[model samples]
Target: MKRPLLFLVACMIAQLSFAQSKDEKAVAAAVENMRKAMIDGERTALENLADSRLTYGHSSGLIEDKPTFVEHIASGGSDFVSIDLLDQTITVAGNTAIVRHVLHAATNDNGKPGKVALKILLVWLKEGGEWKLLARQAVKEPAK
Candidate 1:
């Protein structure tokens, strides 16, 4: 009886692990798509990736809603020349995912060239069989 109970428990654990791994991969893909859209200035793609009630917070303490964030990206207000995400981690909790990463990017915001290194946290929610970015926040990383 004990052996059977242990086997059952192990199988359940394995199933949970597999499910989490699958969810993590999906979340990572969603994040990558969002990054690609941002780099390409694809407003429609960005909108699709983001939830209708998105809260985007910048390193400079500015916060934007979904429409404002999409408008800024579309109008070249926050143009990313190149973005490199490093040390990314994703955690899935049921239908929600939390992602953290270091972002190093070369940016040209309205032709003002600049570089930024930031620690970013993103919240994604799985809704209607899709993952959408619900919130994101960035903080400037200290020079190393």
Candidate 2:
């Protein structure tokens, strides 16, 4: 009986570990898609990932609604040449997930080319069988 109990515990541990790994992978992929959309300036891709009631905040201290945000991207207000996700950490609780990461983005600052580091937080909600970004906040990091 003891041996059987031990085996059951081991099996449970392995299953839990596997589930965690899978969750992490899923979160990473979703975040990557968002980054890719931003880099490519594909407003459609970005819009699809966002909830209809998305509250997006930029490093410039501007807050925009979903349509406004999408239009800005479409109008070339923001474009990323390269985006690197650094030190990402994700915490998931049921249908809600919080993704925080340091982002290194290479882009032209209003026609002046440069790279910038930004600390970003993205809140995602699983709604109607899909995960969508509910809120996003980004703050520019000071130059070292």
lDDT of 2 by residue, 1-144 (tens): 999999999999999876655555677778998888888889889889888999999898999888987877756777678999889898888888999999998886467688889999999888876778899999997788
Off by over 4 Å in 2: 1-21
CA lDDT scores, all candidates in order? 0.95, 0.85
Q: Candidate 2's C-alpha lDDT?
A: 0.85
RMSD of each: 4.0, 3.4
TM-score of candidate 2 relative to the true fold:
0.82
What candidate 1 gets wrong by more than 4 Å, as runs, is 1-20
| Candidate 1: residue pairs that collide | none
Candidate 1 TM-score over all chains jointly:
0.87
Q: After aligning candidate 2 to the native by TM-score, how far in Å is the CA of 53 from where it should be?
A: 0.9
